[model samples]
Target: MRSIGLILLLCTSLDSYKILIYNSKYGHSHSNFLGSIADALVDAGHDVTSLIPVMNPKLKDGTENSKIIRIEPDQQVLDSYAKEKENYNYFELNSFNPLIAIFMGPKFPKKFEYVCRKVLDEPGLIDRLKAEHFDVYISENFDVCGTALAHAIAPKTMIGSYSSALTGQHFSEFGVPEAISYRPAAYMTSLDVHSMVDRAWNFYASLHHKYCFWFLRLSINRLMKERFGEEYPSVAEQSANVAYVLTNSEPLIEFAAPTMARVINVPGIGAKTPKPLDEYWSEVMTRRDQTILLSFGSVVKSIQLHPAVKAAIVKTISRFPSITFIWKYEEPDDEFAKEAAAKLPNLVLTKWMPQLDILAHPRLYVFITHGGMGSTQETALRGVPGIFVPIFGDQMKNAGMMEYNGFGKVFDKNNLGDADKLTATIKEVLENKKYRENAQRISKMLAKKPFSSKEQLVKYVEFAAEFGASAALRPQSVDMSFVTYHNLDVILASAACIFIFVYLICKMCSRTAVKLVALISGKTKNE
Candidate 1:
């Protein structure tokens, strides 16, 4: 048909620009996410270069049609900041992945400083990146240095973070709903319960980020001024204000904030291409059996699970014969996990399992997760209910949001006891139709977008590269005073201050009146 020919002609005329992605010094998931974006861009005829921390073997083997640049930060500098002992938070130094602590939120600031130092000291790293002459730079928001690198270069920057705008990255300033803000622990969101908490978290995080921007600007200006004769003009303003944020999420899974206009929800970045069910998993999905996929994600293996928590899961799942539990663990030789696997006929434990592949299976009835954003997005994508046991960082917030949407349940990892309670919750998710219906409804909404979410990411990056700046959805001109945003508290404080001032003035005047009366009475006594 003429229409088909014209479509082909239009596609042929569209040119792909050179794109550079930077994701260094983070978990494997972030690297994989960047790689997926790069792969997508390359497939779309774009010249793509990926900059990642030199860790996994897969990263070393550069993919065809793409140039992969590895940055091995100076080991000496890394060693200086990194704990000599194997601190779980700095686990990336040990092997292909980093060991995230049970409490990852409090430790992030130190990690940020350590990463920043590495970016500055690495010889030839910045120069090599500059040499690429990239038109656009794509990176995760947590990689502050990556954003800085993109700013240092003339290219446009698009941020892709696991935390989304919840961490006060983009949407917080733009009046996005606060219920999605970052939290220290994991919990489920109940529509009637946690919306207020979410809003409070967003308010704090927004202010925190505003402070960060000011601090970075001041530091950069001071550093540049000291080194060069002139004040740093680049530090004077945000570089291009970010064309838009490329979120690795679907809006249907969660209520997207004011950022809906700027967000490009490119879900399933790390997932395998959707294909025909291979029969093995499909067969498993059949029957009246309810199923659950349990994993902490690629970075944190199930083997690292605290023994008490592992025992709780084992004991809980043992009681349910009709429900099947699949735990993606990493101990091929560990006898403990194997023994548990042997003891529980209803549970399937494996050294490695394809998570996305499993979640997509029709039999997947529920997800027991650590509340990682990527995993939550996948859970939402499959229209599967979940039980959230957040370990640390923003996992709590993710879990809380899911609970709020009525798609999941959340519990604390620190006090994760009572196998009976967990088992009961699992049974509820399986038996109740509400969870399934809500999840399906969200899935439908996520699928309504016109194009692949990554395409939006690509378009924004191209626009930024072509146009020097993007109109910031969250403008920097707005007043950040605490009094202005949350006015009731300020009004109360002002009222109290005025009352005290007036009372003091009146007391002083009354004392003066008493003194004058006393003086007049003394004159009468003298006469």
Candidate 2:
């Protein structure tokens, strides 16, 4: 009776916090990542509120479970955003240019600064947030507005959430450790950090990424100061003060680097468990002996694919008459896509797809993907081999991992027009039994981890709420200057000491030799 009573008391005494998760409802991956965290917290019995801004109209729901408050940017911002997006082709070669990043990267966020301005100016919203007295505040670091919103709320503990793998910003601004010697950069094609050439390229790419990211962050910071008074802290300053990050990076699969204790890894935090396929999709998967699903993710549309590339893909899939190919072609009116779809009886064209449901299908043999982290992480545990076609940014790095892990191969984007190459690569993955075996092995390993991603997330949140900004976990190197951090100052000092020591010894030796010569000459004269 006493033991049972003690157990009940312990359970009752455990804390349930009021958590405010700010979802920047624009990018599918970013919003989905934050939304999942909100739902997870709510499921864990915390009070979770989702503060969302309508960055993209398509992604309307910030979170499925949390209490919602939507921020609508003025029509000017919306009009400008919609205008820019209408013409933007994210898959273009120069979309990731550093000069463009430095110059025009902030232009979009600068416009969206109105979202934060509106939030702060609203008396009712401010009063309601203050009333909540949130124990923990979490927001995506892609935009500084979300982080700035944390300042207004003044939550007990503030945290930065990364939807994808942490980049150079996490190392330079926050306390996550990154090394040029061994860690791969997200922007480059090379994944193997051990090779000298790869390391050198990584050094160059890492510097480029850091430089570009600096300007991006700088632009956002200046915009914050311009909109809100100078009293607001810089985004980097706010991130550092948090002393913790919840990232959607899987340690088991990601390129190994030094990571702080506070930077928690929860890979599947945003992933939904695969639900049973509906009748239409279930019937389609079983229609063929094997199925191949081709998708370029939400941001990178299939319609933007070069006509030659589309022709090559259509030709390659046509070679396999037994395989049922499901292609997520975003546009219904593409004349070539429509013509090819009609001729190829096995090919199915979709403007939208239940990608998760399709990937989980038993008959699904392979996936041709854009290597976006959201899809990559979700697909990795499904035991399906893929041909990764990376478009840009971290996607290239994500594609390289497919080959690194031996479950799949990285297809060169430049060779997409070559039907022969495309067909050969697809055939290789299809014929090679080892690819399937390796994928299954990795899936089982990921599934049998010590704890689930949700448990890791919940425990870390609880710990952060109780004890904010852990100095012990934060690397002192985060604040150190380049010279200091690299030990170059200490190296120069040691070099100077060594030079002086050698000079003194040489001088003594020369003096001794002169004295010896004089003594020898005198003795010879006396004799």
Candidate 3:
């Protein structure tokens, strides 16, 4: 009996895995996605080690089996980031311009390289990671350094990538079919309806995405060669070896694009279960006759808004004295923002607020958001309508999708200075019953999936860990040349064959005509 018990314990121990999650991005949404996955793994009796940027706040709570390592940025990188934020202009581009955004994509690899360098500079960090013998490595797909670190630390481990959305080009590299004609790019604000003009733009955007990703991979490869020697695999190669990809988008919100079997859509992984509001916030929500939560997400704070725009928002909110507005202003100490908040009796400003909790509140009427994916998904999950004022990145796309789904209304950020337009739009959405009803319908649809996002995520992750890489799942198209994969060669050959056949027929007809003419001349001579 003792021997059998010991064997059962050993089997259980063998089933547990050591997992490594690398997310170096500074954004809270990115960290939250990774943190949620780590938490899930820990709950499933697996050991998790997360390497995240120090700039992001720590995860809420960690179990004893889970460990977090904060990778600090280089001093120069920190200074540059601060300076960039200080001089940042939110309205420089009219909207999310694909050309400009594609050009900017390559710049991220340099920052990622800097972070990797900083990690390597830490004493004994590499050696310690090597000793851990992680069974699997999950990396943020946006940053190349994560994959590079995975290769350097645990070469034999199963690798997977997590993305906040379906990056069409990245998936294309793995031979995933792209629905560029009808599906809009993540950075594009267009809807899924494909008019000729829309298709043209989509084609252009797809090409631009391809170029951007190629450049990014080249940049990372050069950095890897410079640092880790010439034998190191390129970022593209590393990505090709990945066993699975987890995307934080669903077909209901994302355009209906066909994805590979290995690509898992876990749309609401960042969405936390709505907890009861804290005492102070609960009282605040109850005291107000109606409440609106306005947040621009973590990266873009309300205090960073242009002075004119800020004034206009304040003036607009002041018009509706019956409704309370809770703004998540990152710099609550700023005198200008403070003065603006004080202008309206119903306005409340705080450096931070429980956004998800507030969205779940019974009295919360609407959410005024920047249309970030995390915010969009959370609001959709909570069955809340929104007023989206998208600024940059995928926000414009998310806004368009939200409006198309009838869950929200989008107002251009450039029009924020027009108080009348902004105020009227807000009032229109607030007064409309269809928006709330639509949001509720979407929430129901989102909840109708067979398995929850967390459940699917854990199941696939464990599957990948148990069975190494899923090479057989990869399509043969991945190994084919671009021209061959598209069948351009076959098309050109068929065209050539038709041309040759037509030439031969024309030559025979000409010869026959010459013979007839010669015969007629001979008959005339005889006469």
Candidate 4:
């Protein structure tokens, strides 16, 4: 219930630091994440500026707050993006190819590289940013260019942020813990590790990430050397200075894993408290005892969903006549959507819906989602059970996380069109009391957690400002050789010591027996 406005009033005694948040225009969730940080810092009476490098020519910041600097993508960047977009339909597949998630579609990294080059080459961009004299710099660690830019500015305190759970990806560069024994890798298909085989796969997945991140540093260091003098620091060296990482993952929902004080788990950081509903949705909620909202989010178009899947969803909705369904279909005007809406009065198709408010509705029963981190966190915080059909990225693992947390079920994307199974899954989540109970319990825990996410952000930024990327917070484990970090050297040394001790003992015993046998033989001869 605490408003940012109220927080602003109480900020009179606080010292305001000039902070810059580097944002990418390519991703909706990523932009929304950076926007939330900017707004939060501004609310805390800090001087915050969002420096957005627009990668997608078509995409722009829909909502505006003051102090935003946007560099539009140039023609070359636009052309590259269009070429990349051709292969970007990776998400529109029936079944998720888990292997591709591990490598990450090559096009994105290429496109990001091109975009970063253009942004860096922008006239006066670096000088303009440096002129701000920012004390703090915050950026998502996914793009090393952002970190490189932060290094050029050389803020007193730098912070890295993640929009999704820390998937043990790039933890090496970020200096966060990535022990794979219990932790799930970013691209791992599931959060639940039951067997040694599962643990082994998680370890390999985590290692793959670490290797890729290491290579990325090499790649970016070359770029840094070219841009600045060859004396410029490597990506790893620059990131080593980051004070802390504000992660979006809620710790309570996660399985047991090693974490560092440097990694701040700010659950529901960007999630907004639900606003009051208007007359239409207000009336609609009252019409049914149970209501469900189905959305695949902005990036994944529901219209593009397979015909069979849509049919299965429509069939599932028909069976639940008593439970009203709200579908956020992009093309509500599509013939299939129109026909379905006409046939089923309980099923409503809308191009846009007040998603947060709908989830907060009193009669809200369940949510059907793509398991995007934003949706996953929002649904969890609102105490809504869900059926997740993850198509790509960490979504598959995110779906597993939700199910593991006990508030949801992961419906395989390939089987989404199966009416019997789809209906059964929905009915199970809807009718089962356990799912709702778990959701409510977790939601209450998040709401009443020791620190408000807003407070964590404000307090941490101030802490960093005071101490300036305190190395005391970092573990000595960072930058250790692979053998040393795993203590394999120690293990090998101990094994060798045991072998030598055993060998010496056997040798002494053998010599003693030989001397005794010789003495016995001589005594027998004399007799």
Candidate 5:
């Protein structure tokens, strides 16, 4: 018995690990993904220390078992960047206007660099990181600074977490085949079954994405060199050292794209299990025969919506007196919204609500959302059909996917002021049996996965830490140059060979014809 106890203790000690997580994004959904990973790591008997930006939504306080460190940036710099980000138009990318890219592209990189520098400049942060001696570093992939920080900390292993759906260019960076012919960009509305024009557009979009990132990498590298000294490696080099990437995507829902073995899909990692609604909310939901959840996600506030659009939504929903509408309005004190809510007996206005809990409720008939990836996946998990109003970024693409899958419809945000169109779209979604059927079909397919997302995430993280890096998992293409990786050199060489062979064949034929002509002339002269 003494021997067995000693062996068990040894095994436990061997299994324990220390992990550091960096999540600098201030968005709620982004933070949720990082927080979920931290929680899962802690549950697996690992010590997790999370470093987050002070502007982010407060995560749960650290217990004796785990730690959370918040890094506060210079107040003035943080405020300036926050205001700029708030005003930036993420929707311009979807306008299909080349001029928009020209105007926004240069500005985006500068802003991103500024934010990264500010986060790293936090006092005592570097000293704290140097002392941790974490076995592994996990960070969200949106910011290159996280990758830089990981390199600076010099962890045994590094993992990148992508909170959004997969992008073709992102896959290409790791030498994963993008299959752009069929796989649409996350911001595109193209389908797998595409026409020649669609394929052309996809190819162009893929190139643009690759080029933009290449330019951004150059900019980040210059910034890092200036800040960290010329001896330090570039951001791209740091990114290449990443051993694994975890994506928030499901194969069943997203368009198929080739992924490296190291790229793991753990869709909906941060989604909460359904919980019982509070008494008042439970009573409210019970009173209604049918309920619709209307939320534009965390970034887009309901109170800030155009007055004309708000009036249109109210008018459209009011047409259905029997149905209850639960709007996740951010500002409950807004007099305009309050007055409007008072006039409608069926409308409920709340500043905060348990989104997942409400979505899973039996009364929920449909979800009217802004098509953020988090909300999109959650709705899919609950098998609830949606009416997507995409405002920016990948939201339009997600909305298109929802429509293509027959689970919902995409209502143009430009038509928000049109009550009739909004009413027709809502009516169509509610009355269509195909929409509900497809949603349930997708839900069942996702449910059939062998392992839960949490299980897959925890397993891969542990594997990466134990193994350090998988040489076999790192593809040979990672070592290849851009020309070789894309096979451009091979294509050009093949074209040259074919050209030379064709030229030689034509020359031989010409020489043979000339000899025959000479023989005929000689015979004629002899006669």
Candidate 6:
């Protein structure tokens, strides 16, 4: 493990550019990703400054190859996160159900503005960012205004990082059409969990996301143009033109679309390393026994599980006493705790386990995940088959892709059955050699490349800084007619149809009048 870390450290020496990585939000997963990339860059011998907001942060120069800029998260702003207080409640089936997940698309602009204003006002944060002339700005695509803010301050380029499915919704904002059916890699092909009806709904939901992202981009660009001068390019143009985007996912976990060679595959960047306290490893693999890790992911906590669903899982897994169940319960409770004891002797309940650590454990055999990108990568890297319970967003797409690749199964919350099915699925993954074989094959492919995806991304950042945005990417369709740009083709086609119909009607009317006159004159002459 130390040697692997050393190798990673040595790889960092390959980079020579100064890069500023920004992830001001509080989520551990998001921050961990930023920290990973920054560490890699600094290890490579580049001047790297990281902007982070933690309650109490530790900033030690690990390799003496980079610097850390620590800013206290604005308590005032942190206090205003009233939305964070709301957790998923499975009892309120309305809240935890898949239907509600579709409705909870990307946040609106007002919400984004609220977050942006707080970030800007975080006492000297903006000043600190502007002071450091960054060559490239890297951030999660979901964080609304920070990237735009970075773009405004210096002649820097923006690189987008996201954990899961890079849906049509995201690319469409940059004028790329939604090709929902086009899964770019073998992993995305496995994620076909939707029924015919679910597929249609997923398509519409993805299309809806495109509009949501477009609206947000439009609003951000408009505000930025007034404040910074030039209208910003679309996210797609920005993505395509940027030096590189390092998706924290593998081609084996989700499908990425093939675009102009800028999007790079850098899997496992967000993977969690194994932790020591995972009791399931202790319980199931005491002497090399096989184990299965069950977790719903960070956003969808297991404690939020519907009581019925919990009961079903307990009843089913109770039969498979040989396998270990590491349920990621965010909080502890008497009922859930006792239920674990009653279910199976091999069941080891955990409030939290180092997910990546648990997956990487040698005895681990299967994973039941919410199909998060981070978890997806960990599962792929660990070479484990999965039972996917897709709750929302790209999770649905990811679950579908994994199933498509013969590595997993999708059990929708609405139709998830009894313990027999659950036990059967686990047995199938454990007994069937194909699952392990496929997972290992994909993991090998993910690791075959010489440079980690982040290193390649750093190269792109330097490329963008050296060359202007124009050099990195050209504007696609700049003729900005509001009506024409949106769908003038439809309007033009409609206008042509109207003209033809009018001419045909006029010609028929003239012929009818001539016939009527001729008939009247002939009758009068005969009389």
Highest-lDDT candidate: 2
Question: What TM-scores do the predictions have?
Answer: 0.73, 0.91, 0.90, 0.90, 0.91, 0.76
lDDT by residue (tens digit), candidate 6, 457-513: 556666665664554343253333446656888888999999999999999999999
Assess the local accuracy of residue 90 in candidate 3 as a C-alpha lDDT between 0 and 100: 64
- Candidate 1 residue 351 C-alpha distance from true site, Å: 1.7
Per-residue lDDT of candidate 5, residues 1-527 (tens digit)? 99999999899779988899887655667777778888888888888888765443333322224477766654555666578557754433354556545665665566456666766677777767878777889977666667767767878899877788656446644557777788777556655544888888777766655555565666777777887789888665565667888888777777656777888888888887899999988987887789999998867777666788789989987898999998988777788778878889898888888889999898899999999889989889889999998887678778887887887998888887899999999999999899999999999888888899989988888888888877777777756777998899999999999999999999999999999999999999999
Tens-digit lDDT track for model 3 on 432-501?
9999999989889888877888898888888888886777777777667779978999999999999999
Clashing pairs in 5: none
lDDT of 1 by residue, 379-482 (tens): 77778898887665556567877877878778665544678788788878878899889988887776675776667756766666676445555444232443
**Residue pairs with backbone overlap in model 4:** none
- TM-score, candidate 4, is 0.90
Residue 521 displacement (Å), model 4: 3.5
Instruction: Give the alpha carbon lDDT tens digit for every residue of 1-527 in model 4.
Output: 47877776667536788888888787777777777878888888888888887887566552256388787776777887676555555445523244544565433366567667777888988888888778889888777778877768878889988887775444666666676777777656574457888888777666655555554555666777898988898766676678998888887777667777888876666777799999999988888899999988877777777787788889888998999999999888889988998999999899999999999987999999988889999988899999998876667768878898898798887777789998999989988999999999999988888788889998998888777888788766667777997899999999999999999999999999999999999999999
Per-residue error at 157 for model 6, in Å? 2.9
- How far out, in Å, is residue 410 in model 1? 1.3
- Model 2: how far residue 186 lies from native, Å: 0.9
Superposed Cα deviation of residue 302, candidate 3 (Å): 1.9
Determine the C-alpha RMSD for candidate 4 after optimal superposition of all C-alphas. Answer: 4.2
**Clashes per model (N, Cα, C within 3 A):** 15, 0, 0, 0, 0, 21
Which ranges of candidate 1 are over 4 A from the true structure?
1-14, 55-65, 76-133, 156-163, 169-230, 233-236, 260-265, 269-271, 276-288, 470-527
Cα lDDT over the full model 4 = 0.79
Error of 2 at 379 (Å): 1.3
* Residue 246 lDDT in candidate 4: 83
Runs of candidate 4 with Cα error greater than 4 angstroms are 1-14, 57-63, 80-107, 189-194, 208-218
Worst 10 residues of 4 by lDDT: 93-102
Query: Model 2: residues >4 Å from true position, as ranges?
Result: 1-14, 94-114, 123-131, 223-232, 518-527
